[model samples]
Target: QLMSVVAVGDQLVQQQHFGAERIQERLQDTLGNWNHLLDLAALRRKRLEEAVDFHQFFADADDVDIWMLDTLRLVSSEDVGRDEANVQSLLKKHKDATEELKNYASTIEALHTQAGQLGEQDRTAPEVVERLNSIDHRYQELLELAKLRKQRLLDALSLYKLFSEADGVEQWIGEKDRMLQTMVPAKDIEDVEIMKHRYDGFDKEMNANASRVAVVNQLARQLLHVEHPNCEQIVARQNQLNHEWAELREKAEGKREELNSAHGVQSFHIECRETISWIEDKKRILQSTDSLEMDLTGIMTLQRRLSGMERDLAAIQAKLDSLEAEADAIEAEHPEEAAVIRERITQITQIWEQLTQMLKERDSKLEEAGDLHRFLRDLDHFQAWLTKTQTDVASEDIPGSLADAERLLNQHQAIREEIDNYTDDYTKMMEYGENITAEPSTQQDPQYMFLRERLKALRDGWQELHQMWENRQQLLSQSLNLQMYNRDTRQAEVLLSQQEHVLSKDDAVMNLEQAENLIKRHEAFLTTMEANDDKINSVVQFAGRLCDEGHFAADKVSKKAENIADRRNANRERALQQMEKLKDQLLLHQFLQDCEELGEWVQEKKFIAQDETYRSAKTVHSKWTRHQAFEAEIASNKDRLVRVQQAGEELMKEKPELAELIAPKIKELQQQFQ
Candidate 1:
């Protein structure tokens, strides 16, 4: 049991030595990690100090060093726990310090960039100077506390150099100093001049330095108080001068506008005056006597003048309108003058209208008067033509003269109607107030009354002459009929005398019939002549003589017709016996006449058959045959005896011998046959 105890003790001693070796190795490894942590912290602290030195905002560099030292102390402590918890605590402290150093470094970098820009700024301005002073104080503080001496010193010296080179501040300070130095008392005018010059110079310098305005203004007040003895009076005088100058400028501008308006008004007024002159001239022309005597040429001239006047009036009106517009532009200033001009224009327009009306009335009156005058002349010519036509109609035939006179009367009537119409027109003109000075007199005019009376006389005379001509024509026609009746009576008497010796019953009967026709014609002529005797006095005696002659001829023809009737009754019974006796005597005469030819053919009494006897038939076959042939040959001798007896009666009137012999034989044969 004691040997086993001794072996346990030896085991315990070996285990203790092995445990000591492991603890020493673990401590050595932890010490090495702590040393590395210290080195990293130290490097971070050094960089943080350098950042703090470069810019004032990095002043947190000391806090990083304190935190690193505390962490190292914890790591090197003998009694402290060097376990995982302690190591983690130490690592956490180092990380916190490192993060703080990074934050500081970032802040310092931004501040350094700001300081660099500030160095280039105009430090003469108050806000910039103030900011520079504050930056300088912070830089000095940072320089004293920073561990990186070289960078801190460099940053502090740069801020100092920027402060020193700020020329804008020196300029501002110099201006203020000059303003104060130039201040002087105004004991005399010369002193005032000298101080005024000094203030002018200070104002000129401060005008360029906008940042030094407050100090410059303060100094300017001090100088003004010293330079002027009565500062308030001088300021008041200056203000009054400025006020007067403004008033003068406004008045001058108003005067310029007024002058322009006045020129326009004057120009328009002149134009109006000229237009009025033209109107007056036209009015005078319209009132003239020549205007009343309106010929074509004169009327045309007046029309041309009126046209020109109208154009002038239009021009004047246009000018007036332009003037009115111009007046409206300045009416606020010149209302009374514009109103007066407008009134004048209105008056001129009224006068022009009156003149135009007068001219038109004058033209109408003149034209009416001219028409009346022409009508009067035409009436005179018509009267003369009518008188000449009346003279021509008196000497002409009824048919021709009446036709021409009626036509002339119609023409005269037409002209008279036209004259009446013209006179009515003239009366109308008078009623309408047309002053027709040259109008011909109408109602009391001698020529018109004379023409009317003459026309009535001519119509009456034409009717009387027409009646006379009709009476004369009837007398002439009756006279011609009387002459024809006398000629026919003489012709009937000659026809009755020619039939006085006609013993033939047929010839005497024809004579009686013709006498009856003559008697009938004579009765008709007597009736016509008796009917027209009163109307035709010149033919009454000649018509009575013709009637007597016609009655005697008709009575003679009737007596001869009665003789022919008694002779016809006696001849009827003896006609056949007379015809036989005439034939026997004609045979005896023919036989005795052909005795030589018969003696040659038949020496004493025998039939001689010779060529001459046969050709002439002068020989008889027997005494009895010869006698019968002789009787036949003389049978037509009765017609010859009748013709001879009638011819013999005509010969008896002429006392011819053949009539005496033939009449005796015809009378003896007629007595024997009866």
Candidate 2:
């Protein structure tokens, strides 16, 4: 039991030692873990210090450093796991260090934020002091600005109060000077100087206001003393002036309208002169009344002048009406002459309107005199133009050729346009003549008589030329037709000659049908030639001769064909008789020669009888003579012997007894032939 106890004690000691080693190992691991945590914290703090410029926040950086040292000491110490109290204390210290580090980091972040806000990498005391000094200086300046603003407000209020009343300007000036003197020492020199300038401006403004007030007072007094005109009296005077001016203006307007309506310059100028005189008289009277100084005598005098002008205007108008009526009578008597005279008068009137100012510059009274001179000049010019126009019309020639006609037509169109252009001018002149006070000279007034004569001549001449051209064209057409007819007739003649030559062949009978067709074609050409005989008589005659020749040739060829046919018939008849006789003789000779069967010799006899050489032998004697002459020819022929032998062989093959009976006879004949 003691040994066992001793063994247990040893086991307890070993177990205790093992537990101590394990505890040491565990403590070492905890220390390592803590060191690792410290390392992380150190790295974080270092990065924070570098990135955030932690030295700028010295307090926060120092606190973080102390926390780091405490953390390091706690982690490095060996008493961490000595007891529970020690362990608790170590944990508490670590926790406190962690908290301290967190707090330091927060403080550093806040300082960094502040540095960022200040736009500074290092928030040093010098920079802070400099900023504070700048703020202080700005505050001083603001305070000075506030004081100056307050003083300016006071001055403005004082000036406003002073200027409010008219009687306070002088007292305000005195007060402003005293206040400036008082402010010289207490205020900034600049503020004092500004106040002085404001004071001077206020003084000047007050002076100007005083002057304005004095002027206003003076104007007010003057207004009080001035009296307005009586409304009724002034209105009455204006109405009277208006009535008088209206009377004069109405007269002048009537005269102007009348003068404008007058076609003649003489009447127009006279009316214008009276109207202008009346207007001048009215203007003089109006000037007298413009100053409100018109009297009854002046008005009566104006009325008298106006009355005289009216009387004169009425007399002139009456004379103008009478002259116009007489001119109308004259125009009715000779309308064309009156028209020409009026045209001249209108031209003169136009010249008067254009040169009125120029003439007036030469002579004030030239309004009438110039119109007279212009009328005379235009009259002479118109007469000369009339003479020239008559001559031009008489000289106008008719167009000769087509091109000349076209040109003359264009010229005629141009002249018509010119006449149209003259219409307005001529009408205006006629109207002027109707309004003229005098009669115009009428030496020669041909009007458009010469133009009409020339137009008629041109028309007649053009008609004649057109007829000539038409005749020439017709002649040319006839000549062309004649030429075409001649060409066709010659072509028909050539065709007829060819047809005749074709008919002349020995086969005229065969070609007779074709020749008849050609005859029909030739007859058609002859018909065409006859139809156009008037155009091509020579060609038609030549074509007629060719047609006659073709007909005669065709008749001759037809008769020859008929005679040849008759001769052929006769010859055929005689050949048939001779053939018959030759056949009979052949049969008789064969019978006489004791050959009843002549076989192929009968066909040979028939063929020889129809031969051309014996064709003309119509008599039996002649045929016999021919046969006798051919007998010698038959005897010398080897072909005849071979033919006879072949015939005898065929006869033997066909009829052996008959052949045997004829063989002797054939042998005899063969012997005779040999």
Residue-wise C-alpha lDDT for candidate 1, range 497-557, written one tens digit per residue: 3333221333121233444444454345445434533323222344454345553344443
**Highest lDDT among the candidates is held by which one?**
1
Which ten residues in a row are the worst by lDDT in model 2? 292-301
Q: For candidate 1, what is the TM-score?
A: 0.19
lDDT for model 2, please. 0.45
lDDT of each: 0.46, 0.45
TM-score of each: 0.19, 0.16
- Report residue 123 deviation for candidate 1 (angstroms): 46
lDDT of 1 at 347: 74
